[model samples]
Target: MDLHYSPFDFAIQKDPYPVYKRMREEAPVYRNEEDDFYALSRHADVVAALKDSERYSSKNGLRLEPAFWGPQAEQIFSFVALDPPRHTRLRALVQSAFTNKRVQALEPRIREIGKAHLEPLLSGDTFDLMHFAGGFPTDVISELVGVPEADRAKVRDLGMAIMYREPDGGPVKDLPPSAMAAVGALVGYYTELTIDRAKVRQDDLLSGLLDAAEGEDRLTPEEVVSILILLVGAGIETTMLLLGNAWHAAAAHPDQKALALGGRIEDWVEETLRYDPPSQTIARTTVADVEVHGTVIPAESRILLMTGAANHDPAVFENPDAFVLGRDTAGSLAFGYGRHHCLGAILGRLEARIALEALTAHIADYEIDEANAVRIGSSNNRGFASLPTSFTAR
Candidate 1:
């Protein structure tokens, strides 16, 4: 069999671990001529590239699609696409608002929101877990961003539209017109929200972002809108997918699922992240000619740091395929590494933990209707779009 890998390939996207394993052993520095990108599948190489931002630059956003890659990438990805200095400054200012205190304080509210959403879905018969998975995080983020209750559904729909694509397409090379429209709509909506918040300051993240100052500097209106837009995908979509993946994985492994349901929510979150993460591939551009495993990847070349492949490398994880709870996942790149590490990670985990805790409090067990489960088609993300699940209530 010939060695071939492309993130755009639907078959590969559906279950990439097999191909990732092959790439790790056969070609650590794998190249796909069809997509015009190089991929690093080995754990060591992916981690090294993630850490050495100087060589593996993130200036071209995190995905290789034509619409997302380039100097203007930050408009969509915000500070995530920027290299140091600029990244450092903006992150600092944003952090002043997205403080630990702010996130930690949301636990009570997260529980409240969790109960509000989870209670209705526990009607006994099969219900799509995605209904809960998708709505919970959006409401949480909307609450944080000061979005009115009426507007949250619209926000979630827009976010879902942006993250969705047909999993059986030719090649998801770029965002379709519908997704582009969703982006424009979200931007316009946030622009109005930010402007309104500016007029009347509220105790929300948006207001905090507007006032987040380093010395005399503060985030401008445009910057705040960009950050909010970034949150629609980062803060909401990622967490939403993580919850769905956790639920689906637990259903697949009953023993591990029992442990998770038996007050090991933290372990559940951590293992799910390592075993099958939402973020599968993150792309970067080579700043200089880089030689890895005898292959010289030229400067300015697009490269993908295959985090999904790295997580399953036996060299790093013992019995990497098993869904083991409480295993050591020390060097996992599930949330990325170094400069580009996900800022919303803490909030993401917190939301998952609380949401699951709420679920376990009510349900004894749940079963996923895998035959009808629909996986969201994305180049970098991997998770369910519609997971019809039946629950056994406690």
Candidate 2:
């Protein structure tokens, strides 16, 4: 009956598929006492829960922890955490920015940015990929969102703080006063930017959102600011993890590295996403009583969808543990499925592909400095906090 996993389990953090497999087979709808929540570990059950938003609402909040900033933060976070109707409306206002055409149009610019950032790092014999290569996408997204080049650093810092919480599932308390001050300053800066964009029309996504939201179901200024926050926070960190994971994969499999640098770079990116997703899990709350894999979940029970586990489910994928490039994992839930699927998935993929291509083309070889590299100690996200790698410039 006690099938809960501790968030601090280093072994599980490193490789959780085995434990997930056991959960899926033995207790797909197991409840944990530590977090006081139910979990859906199997591929089929997680997919059904994600798609059945009507039955599993997100209004209570997406995170495992309770909200601290009151209803405003709750409402803003609800964009991802809410069920349909309201979620559909809010999502529509900004969907254009992530359209296939728009992301395709940005591909060239993203490539250029990747090269520019990677070039400087290649000069050094060793560098932290998390800071240099992994961080480049943050600047790229910032620029695309109309953030001034000078303030990109501030945005990055705030994003890191917001996305990563402490091991106790609480807000980071160790941040210096200066860090909090920076967060306050950035929030005010974004507020002003939203106001400015509202007044003057521009060709950016913010302007487009302002124009589009003028009439029916119009988003308030606060909503716009919150959307911006979500966009930057989600966009930067996930992409950073993708890049770092790719480097880690390549270093582990020399053959895959050659294939990636050669003709199958994109496939490698997809495989990495499947093998080691940035978002390890997503949470949902049951709106009504539901039975998953014969286990009953009571109404209002929190359900954790282990995306990382589902991606490795043997029932859906053959040789799930192997990181085979170009494998047909059509049903892979790496991006999540159904309503709350990642809005920027295409853009994230393109960024990772371009970054990998540039690195493999310019660098001769690389190895992960496991001793120095730091794994981010969080349950929700799986990624390196600092990935130190030594590479030879080609």
List TM-scores for all candidates, in order: 0.98, 0.91
List model 1 lDDT by residue over 88-187, tens digit each. Answer: 9999999889988999998899999989998888776667888888889989999988999999889989988888668656777899999999999999
Q: Tell me the whole-model lDDT of each prediction, alpha carbons only.
A: 0.90, 0.74
Q: Tell me, by TM-score, which candidate is best.
A: 1
| Candidate 2 deviation (Cα RMSD) | 3.0
Q: Which stretches of candidate 1 lie over 4 Å from their true place?
A: none
Encode model 2's per-residue lDDT on 265-331: one tens digit a residue: 8888889999888888877777789987677888978778888888988889899888888899687
lDDT of 1 at 146: 92
User: In model 2, which regions exceed 4 Å deviation?
Assistant: 1-4, 8-11, 68-78, 165-185
Write out the backbone clash pairs for model 1. Answer: none
Residue 196, model 2: lDDT of 86
